[model samples]
Target: MRKAIVRVADLRQQVYDNLKERITRGEFPMDHKFQEISLAEELGVSRTPVREALALLVRDRILVQAVRGFRFPEFGPEEIVEITEIRLRLEPYAVRLAVEVLSAEKRTALAGLIRGEIARHGEADTWVAAHRRVRAALFAPVRNKRLIEAIAHYEDTIHFMRVNTLQDARWRGLSVGGSAKLADAIEAGDAGAAEAAQATLLGLARDSFLAWSAENA
Candidate 1:
């Protein structure tokens, strides 16, 4: 019975991860309703796990409950600006703190990830994953779990937008370049340079997102 329960929990976590990936990759249109039955059928899982996964997503603010069902949360221009502003404010400080405490082994690992991103180039998913690794490493030094989680939550909230921007070849090039610069700064153990590099990267992302939103609008 204990083994069975653990298996069920694992299945539910798998469902949650799959659903979150789809949502982040823009597989679901904005405000598209998520049906537990349909998702369960699609994943070949029981409705119980699907329902649990949806509840978890809702808790993460990735999905919203409507009268009809759960739907992807919709954000407009103002929300984008607000999210970017918050990221800009929090991330640089996180970088500063991380610089003070990053171990040489971790720094090397992060630099390798950035190099991998550059090599991956036009592959959107791989590039994004690599970029996330670097970001996660940079934030690893922050002692406040809540602050780190908040930054992660905000990043997840903007995942679709970020992925969309990354699809552009030009933008991807710029991102790789920025990542290289940031990696260099981190390796040098220069907090000021690392902070500046973080700002540059975030600024590029913010400007690209605003432009993309406007063009799509």
Candidate 2:
């Protein structure tokens, strides 16, 4: 991308994107302290804009300010289960809408997304990339932009937790199988099956996260 001539400050957006990506990738673990002065100095930015960015993350519930400083929010087993349950209820419905309204070209594009994911499966960052593609396909056909915007933020947060859960061999297997099942259900245009598969996949996520939290806690 070419540099713009005149506009809003690029540094702040750059800082925001970098911080958000790191947080999402679990580089900043939950409850890990975030030193604002250090980060501002490292990023070669003023504390003012960095403060703005941190506040944004806080509003998103991705980060929180503790007694000492700002840090990633820690989620327990119950919270993980609750979030997954909500996703199970909502995402399937979105997928069903996508299946119903997707054009032939869009469907082909989604198929290519699956193929792309298969090729990248061995890479360290592939799971999160693959998930974003799969999710975009599901919500692409939905007409409500407002609802999509709202859910997309939460989906990103959930994906962060999921990446951690998938580190387990058992959870990885469940994810692979569930993804295949969801793709097949979408291809078949079976809304009921699609929703069921989504629910089952989320159930696996919920159970796995809960178990991990129990062990860790």
Candidate 3:
């Protein structure tokens, strides 16, 4: 906790990467507040780098400034719908591209990941991790960096909701089925089927998330 990061050149980026990992891993509770001073102390770095990292996270919409510090941003209904619309448009096409170009060996690998997703339904964490791996594998054949980056940006922006959405047992089951469909479509080299499966996958995810948001609201 007290050791400084050895990489001086990318100090700011290191800080950003570390904080982002913690956020994505659900380490910080909602009640926990982040300040430059405490973050620098925790990371054994100067306040300047910590400040810059926090600024970047805010700019990326990963966090929002609070009265005294930064906290995870809470998306409202409108923002959630907008994000869903964008993802629905982008991901299906990406999956189609991936299916069209996916190698047979990589298709086999993707099928393995999806099988794990179907089998690891015991705990939410394990299931979520498996699902994430399959999602990444689904994009392995995508050669377009910009398209992949765009998909990642929206996914990152709603990362918290995506994680929580899988906690619903029914949705998790649906997700596994959808992932299986994606694998089948990819294995068959049916770009059209892959695209349709991807749309269904994203739609189910969005609906579950919207349900959770509505209930929580």
Quote each prediction's TM-score: 0.83, 0.84, 0.89
Q: Candidate 3 lDDT, tens digit per residue, 62-160?
A: 899999989889888788888989998999999888877867887776767677667765246567667767778788679999999999888778878
Candidate 1 structure lDDT: 0.80
By TM-score: ranked, best first: 3, 2, 1
| Top-TM-score structure, candidate number | 3
Query: CA lDDT of 174 in candidate 1?
Result: 82
Q: Candidate 2: where is the Cα deviation over 4 Å? A: 1-7, 122-125
lDDT of each: 0.80, 0.72, 0.82
Best by lDDT: 3
lDDT of candidate 2? 0.72
> For residues 18-129, what per-residue lDDT tens digits would candidate 1 score against the true structure?
9887776567766578998888899999999889998999899888888877987778878887888898888888887887778777767766766766776535556665
Query: Model 1 — TM-score against the truth?
Result: 0.83
The TM-score that candidate 2 achieves is 0.84
Model 1 regions lying over 4 Å from their true place:
1-11, 25-33, 66-69, 122-125
Task: Please provide, for model 2 over 1-217, each residue's C-alpha lDDT reduced to its tens digit, 9 standing for 90 to 100.
Answer: 9987876766666877899887765575555787779889989889887888888778878777877668767776667767776777677777777777876666656656665675577234456556656666667778978768767777666655666777666776677678777777766667778778878877887888777777877
